[model samples]
Target: MPAAFPSSDPAIPTAPLTAEMRDALRAIVGEKGLIEDEHGKRPFVTDWRGLLVGGAGAVVRPGSTEEVAKVVRLCHQHGIAIVPQGGNTGLMGGATPWPAHTGIVLSLGRMNRVLDVDPVGYTMTVEAGCVLQTLQETASRHDRFLPLSLGAQGSCMIGGNLSTNAGGVQVLRYGNARNLVLGLEVVLPSGEVWDGLRALKKDNTGYDLKHLFMGAEGTLGIITKAVLKLWPAPKDVCTAWLAIRDPRAALEILSEAHSASEDNVGSCELMSRAAVDMVLRHIPGTQDPLKADTPWYLLLEWSSARARQDGAEGMSEKMEQFLADQLEAGRVLDAVIAQTGNQSRNMWRIRESVAEASRAEGPGMSFDISVAISSIPEFIARGLEAALDILPTIRPYPLGHIGDGNLHFSFMGPSGMDQQTLAQYKGAITRAVNDLVTSLGGSISAEHGIGIDKLDELSHYRSKTELDIMRTIKRALDPQNIMNPGKVLRL
Candidate 1:
């Protein structure tokens, strides 16, 4: 039986969990699955960055999809809100609950399991709770690769990745998490399970509901499982680090390289000298890539399945010649091509370690924005120049998948500044940078989803027409406005 609400007060009731709700929920999931104490529920209630804090009546860990459906149905009956959580590695506070008093934290971490691997079909059926790194390893066991590589692969779950449509290093080649998904198993707000877990490469079904849920950030429904596309592991790969003169030169080089080899090119990442300095100063075992100093650097990679270099057509040698020509043409300042596998790994490590290095450097606001590939050079120059005018000491670490035009533009406060003072300037820096990005017709958020962090910015960026469409869809899907109440588009 559902708990009866107080007729007198409209605000969330302060009443404890009813006996009926507790017993019924425990019956569906064993005692081991329910987390009622503060200690046991601590991890699931907070996000990865500790930016948002939330409270929950209880944290329920369902063991199966069926159990998830049952829990949703029960919560709906009792007017209790449910916040679905996976590995809790989200940067935007999507998995974390709002400060509401009526929601329950529903964790999918216990439901992790690789359901099936179809090597012939080149697909893998996995539960939403499966860790991305483990899934990659499982695919590798079958001589295939799940190419959605990211920093949080070891801790971020596939469900959260799909929810955010996460883009990582390989996004330049494989696209975002949405691109890698074939199908999904979703539990709707009404407790109905929509199972679309078919592993077909071509399925032109009506509406394509999977995509709606892909980057929805769990605003529409809770994802229970997914069918992910896989690729045959590359037989040969070459990774190299090049020192470039400027962002304009980097963009030019990327255009030239992509013209030389189409999809064979894997990743093209940009890191400014200022960004590299933070990595070297904060991250131990980090080294400069080039022997000579340059304004910026680029990390480029090539992937091929065939081991043959075609006698006269050596990929590495050809790439070397291309760089040499560019250097002679005065487009490239300097370059260091990785000759061995260890060297390649070491070079990539520096790129991956930029975020941690920034934190150690100081407190600052982070912006993951995208602009036209051709317009990035101007955007960076203009944005950095404007921000520096406000605080001349502000150091901008503008780096990321420049091949795709997505840049992680970060601001580090002046030297020896206290955390309190740095915190005060976050909004001014964010607004200034965002305004510049918007003026250039760039997306405010390229990869990260709009959780609570960017709700206001989303409104400013989206026009009246687009905002109306999003609101209509939200009202139609969640009429009661209970599913992730304050997310993406405001309610």
Candidate 2:
């Protein structure tokens, strides 16, 4: 059996859910919506990584926005804490409820629905629980594209995407979830529903209220629905794998590609030798794209929505010429360009499989960080050196969207290091890397919000004034702190 929730405060009496409160919630969501059994609640209480296992008073699923609001109102009346959950694919422990705290898991999965799609307006109105991939496919059917692609897109819901302000490989061109949203429908801590789902591109009316809940991580409110921006689907896409001398060379190629391709570069990714090796080792049916092994590799893509003129070259031709120029300039030692759709998918699979492959190899401390594009090479060189200085046997496996300067800088413990030994180095390595990133004017938490994992780090790195402002907003919006308590801000 899973351990009971260990409380920090022993003096305060634990509040069990009363029959009246349960009846009220059940009335709002119906009998099928409320999950009270331990077996039924296990998936919602446990995080994806299995690192965080918590307990929830009950798991409630409300199908509609009205139902969700009513459930929140009932929880508010009863003074019961709420933990809004989405797909439960978050890297940070943002969606999981605290074991020490008593709350109901307010899951948005039942709210999954595509309300409207405006191809001409370039907008898509969707429920927060809509899966990212489903939205992407829906957009594709209308000859449009929702460029928010990620590894967990298959399961991660849009609500969690909005709450976390997630960033994916296409962030280099399309921006993060915060940029794609035009409006939001949120359930405030007071059980008040704030409906701001406008598809308009320009609305210069007062402060944009939607921004408040975009990356608030469920601390401010529960995101139930949203108005998302869409783009014309690309007609032509070119994917290429290049073996570069180092990170600096990859950056150089990125600069040249933009100029040569007339800024059609859709994605630019950097992968280390170790990261590639990890993928080939753990992932089946995957072969190295290039014969010669280099210290680093770059996965570059160029895409165009417009069709090619009758006698003109297309994106593929342009990418080929760009790669030729780089090879001649010694920036790219070797390269391979995908000639078919299957080939392109295969190439992307290698890049997307990095996380899974790394996990299969061993436990490691991972960081999602970003610095100025110009300082990426410096940050990688100095940060890796600093980490190696601390523990010489450490394996640095850093990879990410280089165009935006966000790197999933992760380090695998030395071979045969037990879990206990690995835990000892996590803190020191994280601090050393974070210090280097901060000194170079970078953010410690780039795409991933500060869940429980980085709460203390945020307190340490963020300025007192900045922290005070965050707290002030939290207090004004969620004075009761009943919404996802102990997340984003410490009480």
Candidate 3:
């Protein structure tokens, strides 16, 4: 089970939703918009990983931004808390409401729509409930590309992506969700809509208010819509798999690839031998790219906007030459260049299936951390040593975007360890790894925000001054603390 909220009010009295309030909400959202039965609310209350589960007075689905505002206003007037949720695919427990707290889930799944698309301006206006894959396909249809790609793109909604400032494979090239968004339309805690959706690339006015809600995790307000930036589709692309000797060799290859390709490197992902083994074992029909096993592997890719690039060799040819040079130099043990688009996608499938494969293996502790690109090898070295010191049988499976220095460093327990035994060492292992990350000038939470999973870690690692500023902002925007209470900050 997940840890309880530190500031949970046990002595406080609980109040059930009144008939009048329910009737008013029903009037605003209609019959199909409300989910009050226990059976109906189960799907909304449980998290994606089934780690955190809760209860809700109701799960209210609003079809438009105006209806969402009305629901928020009604909840505000009644002193009831409102938990804004979209897709509910978050790894952390941010969108899941607490069982002890009585609140209604304000789901945005029904408001999915692409409002407008401007090919000339390279912008797309979309409702918050639009699926991320839908947005990507829409952009492709317009002869452009949405660079935000992730494993959960098929189901995760744009609202949740904006709420968490999600980072994915393309972040090393295009940046996170924050960089892709040009403006936002948020409904403040006071139930007033702030329409700041502008598609301009340069706006040197005053403070950029859209940033306040980008990674706020819905603590300040609800993100209803957004204007997203798009990019020209890449005409030429290449993918390669490299069997590296170690992390140092991986970093060296990354540097060489960037230099040789003139900064055309799109993504450089690292996977441990243990991680690859897990995927091959759990996922059927998956084969190792290399004939023999190595300590680590890199799934590297490059792309260019122009198809031919002034009659020079394509990216694939360049990558093939680069790999040939590295192999001859003994830096890379073995390498393979993808021959077709299907082959390229198959290579990525192995990388994307690691998380699920690891979970299927057993109970384990996972972390999303980042250090300086130069310190990655050192961080991994010391992290493994520390974890082994605690438990010699611990299996470390650290893999992620090596180009950006953010890795999902996870450790699976020994084969026969029970859940209780594994749970006992979760905190100590987390502290040990996090201590190493911080000591090396890194962040404990890299791409993932400080959701309920990392609340205590944030409070422990963040300084008093930083926490004070965050608290001040939270208080100023949400004085009543009714907007996604007990998230991102302790009450």
Q: Which of 1 and 3 is the better model by TM-score? A: 3
lDDT tens readout by residue for model 1, 80-127: 777787788776777776655456788888889999999998999999
Task: Report the lDDT tens digits of candidate 3 across residue range 251-359.
Answer: 9999999878778898999988898899999988777877656879999999988777686899988998899899988889998999988789878889988877876
List, in order, the clash count of every candidate structure.
Answer: 0, 0, 0
lDDT against the true structure, per candidate, is 0.81, 0.87, 0.87
lDDT of 2: 0.87
Residue lDDT tens for model 2, 1-491: 22222223222112557888889889989999999999999999887766678778899999999998898888777678888999999977889887765769999998889999999999999998999999999999999999999888989999999999999999989899999999889999888999898887899999999999988999999999999999999988889999998999988999988888788899999998898889999999777887666789999999999888777899878988888888889999999999888788878888988877876887677899999999999999998998998989989899999999999998888999865677777778889999998999999999988877787788889999999999899889877677888777775
Worst lDDT window (10 residues) for model 3? 5-14
lDDT score, candidate 2, position 481: 73
Runs with alpha carbons beyond 4 Å of true place in candidate 1: 1-16, 309-312
Q: List the residue pairs that clash in candidate 3.
A: none
